[model samples]
Target chain A: MTALLSLAIDITLLSVILAMLLCMIRLLLGPTAQDRVLALDTLWMCAMLLALALGLRFASIIYFEAAMLIALTGFVSTVALTKFLMRGEVIE
Target chain B: MTPELDTLPVWVSLPVTLLLLLGSAIVLIGALGLVKLPHFFQRIHGPAITITLGTGAILVASMIYFSALQSRLVIHEVLITAFIMLTAPVVAMLIMRTAVYRDLRARERGKTPPAVKDGEASEVYPFSTKKSLSAKK
Candidate 1:
């Protein structure tokens, strides 16, 4: 049973990697900067997902902690960039 | 039902396996939407699909599988799911607002409307100032 579950995890991880690749294409070829930002946001989410999936596959808490940190940083950076674009200044 | 059921634990594993497959497929579809959507505001909705359903399903599967394997609550997957749900939409909203602002500024400067915002419903760019954009007499 454990082996089967590991197999399932492997398959899902592969799919997640494929999804991230698709997001990368959008980041590369998006027609507008806004579209690119959208892609980058999605890319970060995918990376977080990938990390969580890794944690499950390996049964490792460390990967989950790393995923949390990545999610936190990604959220802050994306928000800052958007706010900067809105006001023409990142800092008041 | 005794020997097979005891050996396989089919009841528990069945739903977990299906959920894992389904969640991965949904995430892939969301990524497709992100790639294929025509514009920024439209694409902003794509990852939300992953956050709401995709991440939720996978986390649930993780909870079930990990608890079965480890013989404990194994609820840590909830944290990642919650984080994704809380963050994805906020980022999407901000990106949409920024796109709208950029489009308005470009138009005010006499540039052609950026392709993404051309036919979309417009939002007033709140950053506009009367004197800042006007020429001195």
Candidate 2:
């Protein structure tokens, strides 16, 4: 809410977005499937952090819930992808 | 003007700003490592820092900010911290295991794995080499 906190939040937001772009580069340029999956996992984390920074900037709690959702779904999807890689299918 | 400096005392904002900057800087560094590291194993290590330290700092900042502003505990961010702590290593382990297995399978089939060579189980490709790392011939 103070000026310094506000500026820090803005910086956090921009850096998070940059992190996501770096993840995208890995996602596209990854030499292997696991690399892509790893990139996606990091991407999800950046998004959640972005959401957190946004919530702080706006002084709202709703963004935290959205971050929680992203974290939950991202965990599931990454596990599923890894499973598929390991056994060629998500379920037997 | 709508009071540009609305009411977070320096006591709270100082720590929050420091933590926010720390979190974002670490996040950026981790992502940079992910992109810059040439090998899959090294790349896998990059986001470990992000998942752990970077996210932890940000969540702690959030907790402090919200709790201070609302004058209550407001600690639900801890749930996210716990979930990530429990799950991130598992995900990383699974991915690394899968990569190792795939490489072993390729070796068994007498084909060249992209990031390994010489049929030596321990011989993962080093990042300093200029050889192709693509999953192709």
Candidate 3:
């Protein structure tokens, strides 16, 4: 990677972290479940992006796999939470 | 432990840098909307930008960076993109439906909504605090 690209990745990482902090604020301050759920969804999206950005920064392939794992697990958890929100139960 | 990062020509690095910056900025804007928007219905639309455009841009950047750096096709980013594209809408839709249903039920309960302050609406969330509820009754 070039110097410019490295610097850009750093800035990108900063912005993603800032975004995560914003999501955390919403998650902690939620007065409703949906808001918190919405915040959590956005939070994981930021996490996945963080992983991808990290992969680029370090020139490693492992972070891509980590991003994939975050996406998969985040999706499952969000679905379960949404199901509970909809009907007060995930299994029923 | 950092991998040995060799040089990429300007042609490759420049666009990757732009895409990365663009993706992050968009993600930041989306998160801001989530926090700034007053209502849940309005706020829910915010992350759509992050999930789709922001993710797409970064993944494309990643694809280009990796391919150019390795001198071959490295396209695993595609799988993540596909999974996110397939799942984002479902999650958004289900969450929206739950919100609409919950709001309706709250309306039907015929009790005045708990007073909202600082843009927080008091809806019955599974994770809601109960001490306040007992006092309200």
User: What is the DockQ (computed on Cα atoms) for candidate 1?
Assistant: 0.44
Q: Between candidates 1 and 3, name the one with more favorable lDDT.
A: 3
* True lDDT of residue A27, candidate 3: 96
Q: How far off is model 3, as Cα RMSD?
A: 6.5
Interface Cα RMSD for candidate 1?
4.7
Give lDDT tens digits, candidate 1, residues A1-92: 54555567777899889999998998898877777777787778778778878877766657868888888888998998888778978898
> Sorted by TM-score, highest first, which candidate order results?
2, 3, 1
Residue clash pairs of candidate 1: none
Whose DockQ is greatest here?
A: 2
Residue B108 in candidate 2, Cα distance off native in Å: 1.7
**How many clashes show up in model 3?**
0
- Across B33-130, the per-residue lDDT of candidate 2 in tens digits comes to 99998678878888999999999999999999899888889999999999999999899899998987776667557776665542442445433221
Q: Is 1 or 3 the stronger prediction by DockQ?
A: 3
Clashing pairs in 2: none
Shift in Å, residue A92, candidate 1 = 1.4
List interface RMSDs for the candidates, in order. Answer: 4.7, 2.0, 2.0
**Clashes in candidate 2: how many?**
0
Best by TM-score: 2
lDDT of each: 0.75, 0.87, 0.86
Task: Return the DockQ of model 3.
Answer: 0.65
